[model samples]
Target: AQILQLLRDLVSERDTALILITHDLGVVAGMCERVNVMYAGMFMETGSADALFARPRHPYTLGLLQSVPRLDAGRRQELQPIPGAPRNMLSPPTECPFAPRCRFEVEESRQAVPPLEELESGHHVRCFNPVPAEEWQRTRVGAA
Candidate 1:
């Protein structure tokens, strides 16, 4: 908390940007205005923090958000783990890196890598089949 406060103070005092890199989602949610979700050395998603958190279009991003424990949950909800192991970086696949673990992956996902494309004005995602807004809303309601 103290370290975060000091960093925030520094950002405010100097009017400078801080590029924080970490696996801690809580800290990212609290501190970042924009976020880039990476997997297998490639950017899977990039967007405003609020948009990414509220409606993660990429399967990996959705999985990551689902894996986090919701503090406001009324009861215990089991974290939905991504179903497979991480890709081997030494000899990565030519196809979509997340296909093996992604529930929404299609035949096209296994054929070639998906390019990062803008879904909204500022939100971009690398996916052949992005999650729908309705599904995201349902998940959010269930989590709450």
Candidate 2:
């Protein structure tokens, strides 16, 4: 916590940029202004931290958020682990790396890689079948 505070202070005081790379979403939420979610060396999503947390468009991004345990969540709430093993880096697949584990996978997702498409201003996602806006909005409301 102290280190994070120091980093934050440096960014504010010096007016410099900091590139933080970690698997800790909590830290990302606290420290980052913008976030780029990656899978198998490819960027799955990129957007403002607040926007991404509130409404993750890509399946991998959603899975990552779901896998994190929330402080306000009930004791009985379980983390939804992303199903299936990670893709082999040695022999990367031509299709979307997250397709195998993604619950929202569609036929096109398996045939080719999806290009990063901007859904809203500054919010981009590399997915053929992104999570519906209504679905994410509902989840956000429920979580709140």
Candidate 3:
């Protein structure tokens, strides 16, 4: 991808910062030491790629990961995309904007919008009812 090449060039040039905004997680995984996953004009999660992708704490983040397809050790592969389009960001919005598409959304989620919280050291997510690790694992199992 062009972005990847650019990032490589930037690193080669010893740039201090090269801010890139993109939807490609593969690019993040490849070139970024850290990443911030944003949605509807807000960051849902921000942390090192190793920590965030290795263990996503937010439902929105989990959903984003689930949307991407990965190769299995014993199988051939095709990329899987996230189900549903991103939420429309009108000039103004209310409540948990991603609720409509988030399977984990609950009654409490509808009551208020949550700001980012520090779920773990250096890992932040913007959901009041963050998914526990086991539940996230179960979701992947069910999807499998």
Candidate 4:
């Protein structure tokens, strides 16, 4: 933790770039201005940290966030774990890698990978069936 803080301090003081590759969302939230979520070596989503956290367009990204325990959530809040095992990275499929576990996956998801599409000024997601922003909040709370 001290090393991480020292790195952050050095980067800020010297105005240098820092590329941190981590799966820890807590670290990302604390240190990053931008975030890119990758699945099967392909970028599934990229955006500002605030934008991605506030509204995740890709099912994989949303599933990751929902699966984490949050202190802000009510005591009875349940974690929404992503179902199914991860894809085989040795020989990755040509189609969407997350399709097997994604609830919003469509026929196209299994047939071909979706191109990255911009949803807002700087937010982009690669998904054939992205969760609509209106549905994100509801779905996160198990309302959908």
Clash number for each model: 0, 0, 0, 0
Worst 10 residues of 2 by lDDT: 135-144
lDDT per residue as tens, model 2, 1-144: 999999999999999999999999989988999999999999999999999999999988888887887778889988778899998889868898899898899999999999999999999999999999887876652386
Which residue pairs clash within candidate 1?
none
lDDT-best of 2 and 3: 2
Cα deviation of 52 in candidate 2 (Å)? 0.1
Task: Judge candidate 3 at residue 8 and give its lDDT.
Answer: 88
Positional deviation of 64 in candidate 2, in angstroms? Answer: 0.8
- Superposed Cα deviation of residue 67, candidate 1 (Å): 0.8
Worst 10 residues of 1 by lDDT: 135-144
- TM-score of every prediction relative to native: 0.93, 0.93, 0.79, 0.89
Report lDDT (Cα) of residue 89, candidate 1. Answer: 82
Off by over 4 Å in 2: 141-144
Show the colliding residue pairs in model 2: none
If both were scored by lDDT, which would come out higher, candidate 2 or candidate 4? 2
- lDDT string for model 1 (1-144, tens) is 999999999999999999999988889989999999999999999999999889999988888888787777746667778898998889877999999998999999999999999999999999999998888887752355
TM-score result, candidate 4: 0.89
User: What is the lDDT, from 0 to 100, of the residue 22 in candidate 4?
Assistant: 92
Candidate 3 per-residue lDDT over residues 11-60, each given as its tens digit: 88996776678777777778787889888888888998888777787777
